[model samples]
Target: MPTTPRIADERHRYILEMLQEHGSCKVAELARTLAVSEMTIHRDLAHLARQNLLRKVHGGAVLRNYIELTFQDRAVQNHEAKVAVAQRAQSLVRPGTSLYLSPGSTTHEFALALIQDDLQIYTNSLPTATALARSAPQGLRVTLLGGELVVFVEALVGPATEAALADLRLTHAFIAVTGVSLEGGLTLYTEEEARVIRAVIRAARKTVLLTDASKFGQLVGPQVGHLEDVHVIVSDHIPDAYRQRCEQHDVEILLTADLDVMPTSAPGAAAADRRN
Candidate 1:
């Protein structure tokens, strides 16, 4: 293993270029490719992730998992955790209320978990729209924001979607993110997705976040909003770091394990379904 400022920068460039070409790279593979130890590769990953150049997943770093979207791929990655988070998030919905659900596998499942009727649900996720439409309770209204579908992500983005969000009002906005940190707030793998999420939050009265434990302290492409912008955070587990940050910002955390905690500190009423 070699250590030098120039070498480190070049290695970082190489990793980014590699991800751009191959989508992802394993730690051991990167180590072999760069003629470095796994420790060096891990250090590079940490550096690159902090720079917001890539997403650090278990055992590797990824360019944009969004580019590899598939219900089967996503619906199963953290199936139980996603379901638990979604199930807890479902409490935010009430009949006849409006919601904005951004694109994400968990948000798609959140759509599936909703049983409320006469709800006006707006979204940019193709899968989410379809899921809610097929299983929607009576009187459920689904609005798919019109825009250019992002490649492999099967989600809409661009001006049309942003413009649509500007004209609407929502009771709640439930979005999924690739990362959340005290430094970057909530982030997505791409700036375009981040923009759409920002718009969704802007249109809603309150914001709710849906994610798994892996996203707790992660950093990715770009941020949507800060911790204070979020009213509730629903996750399988809330890391101590995140819990402390949320508490400082007066944000409520709903741990999916028990679904007992509510966003009591937020301006509006705190709510969720109880579990043992």
Candidate 2:
């Protein structure tokens, strides 16, 4: 039978979703999943690449941004940078404090880097919750949000998740984003996840954003909130433009290189040495 437009559209949709979730897909794997030939998968990848929806590589295709890799891929992509950010972010975590952690690879690192025994932690990420449950010290408490599971991100989201966070107030909310820019603020691939992040931000007295240099100055997807919404940002590097923007927003930017100094008592009130 000839390849119908409807079947082609469905295949294209599946390909895009796979790229968005898994970061990339091989021609043979896609063909097998769709019950089509390698030739058909090749055509689909080519079409999507031409549309700027994806980038065709040797025998596979990746998301348009090229760097929007899968969670597992991203975790290893900036391993050192993530560790640095996680280390610096952990400095802000005081003993006996309650905090919420948003889903993402870096936040997962933050979950692991955490050593505070006297703390309460809540998360929507299955991987992070499991890590905390398995390795957390006796004084630490881990709460996993209840809702629809998003396997791609390994997080629970949707209205039920949001409702679970409604009545609680935490000392801090540590979050990760797909991109961050002066104009677009914090962004993620889906509004569903963004909605849950917004809830996390609201439930916390303070918000800390965990991201590496790659996320700087880019706009990825739906807006989670502006830079002003966050109390602090922990990253491997902060671009000059973001420095000025953060100063204007009264948002503190903590660099991994300068983990020697502790966070200031007041947000954005860093010592002269740490000011942008």
Candidate 3:
């Protein structure tokens, strides 16, 4: 049987799809499957690596799965605590203001909790945007930033996203981090994310970090900025060391337990229940 020929772009897409399904791909197998030369397969893998889509191994390529777990996977970790933190963060957001919501499981919860009418929100998380579109108040506006998609994180990032945020001023920036501490400050799993989140923090009048206890003292990737960049920290629990650090920096800490008693003004709570 004669093998059908595929263009370079189509071949690249097929290689990436295979990587996503199997986690890795051998150059020989890819060449045979795509009906291309081994050298051609190698070149395709190299191009994908340049795009930061996959990592090259000795004789094959693999997806960049080691950086962080997919968004759905991380969403299940500390679920209850994330909800509590989201509920508390919802209270601090006033109606009718522009805000930036960074991509993360916790910030996805925060997007679900928002009920404020006439609010303008810019975010890179596809799930967050979809959630708001399906359940947000009629007067709310959600803008999904345009950029390169990072499959594992389920967010759009890269230079295009940074340019979109370059001019806009936000009332608040609700951010989440993989790690937070006095020494590490706000750290994330990738430099791509760090660059975008740092822009968010700079654009807003106040930056509210929505995080849970699990991320309290851990250090992961590069630091986004110093703890001083954050104006408010909403968490389910905080270690005494961090609590003291927050105090020294005059950063206001809002514990979920303390704020949980307050009635939620967001209409999306019931909707969030249904979706869950």
Candidate 4:
């Protein structure tokens, strides 16, 4: 017999495999096939959903086709850069304010950074809630919004979650976007996820866009919002042209390093620095 923790982990993997192979599955059927209790299957589905592995439905789960990477695939990309971005994001949070975190790898890192703080966190990201629940200080309050669980991102969204967010106020919101275009603004792959992100932005007093250099100009889907919606843009590096665009929108850009001592006034020069 597997230990409890091991069983839980295996159950999660099994659920992911089932979704991958069949595109969907029923909860009760999954329980019967796996020889686990219905409650156990429910918990497993919830956990996998938090990782954005699949979307939980009325009776089972379905794979999110718009999201390209599996949970395992995302774990390996730019781990160090994500950590650096997470650390920078954490620096913006003060001790006892309410914060909202959107679902994404970079924002997940930011959630991890809040482990020692005494704060109130509201999120649709199951992974973020779990990370905060397990590691956040004792006095910290973590609220998981109600909605349809998106397995691919391990976050909740939909009418229910959006309704829940309507009553709450947040001091800060850290949004992880799939792509940032100078003209198209901030975009994401899924419309459902994009809606949730828009709610996060609206509920917060300050909105911070957290992304790495690679996310720039990579248009994935529709624009979630414009540069004007965000207060600060935090990235590893922003080319001169992009930086100027952000500045034009009254958005402050923070780069991890100083690219040049004598900064050129031309935004076009900044765009030219990209190394192919």
Question: In candidate 2, how many Å is residue 103 off?
Answer: 0.6
* Model 4 error, position 268 (Å): 28
**RMSD list, candidates in order:** 9.5, 10.1, 13.3, 14.4
**Could you give the candidate ranking by TM-score, starting with the highest?**
1, 2, 3, 4
Clashing pairs in 2: none
Off by over 4 Å in 3: 1-67, 260-276
Best of the candidates, lDDT: 2
lDDT of 1 by residue, 1-276 (tens): 449999999999999887765445679988998889999999999998887777786677766534534545767788888998899887667877888888888998888888888888899989888888788888888999999878667889988999999999888889888777776567666566777888887778878888999876665555567767878888888878778777776778888767466444643544221100
| TM-scores of the models, in the order given | 0.73, 0.72, 0.70, 0.67
Error of 3 at 144 (Å): 0.9
Give me the displacement of residue 123 in model 4, in angstroms: 1.0
Better lDDT candidate (1, 3): 3
State how far residue 265 of model 3 sits from its true place (Å).
Answer: 25
- Structure candidate 1, residue pairs in collision: none
Q: Which scores higher on lDDT, 2 or 3? A: 2
lDDT tens digits by residue: candidate 2, 88-186 = 888888998989999899999999999889898899999899889898988898889899987778889999999989888888889999888776578
Displacement of residue 222 (Cα, Å) in model 2 is 1.0
What does candidate 3's lDDT look like per residue over 1-276, in tens digits? 433355788888998887655455678888898777899888888988999988776667756645577899999999999999998888878887899999999999998988789899999999899999999998998899999999988999989999998888898889999878676577776777888998887677778889999987665555688776777788988888887776666677788889342222233333123211
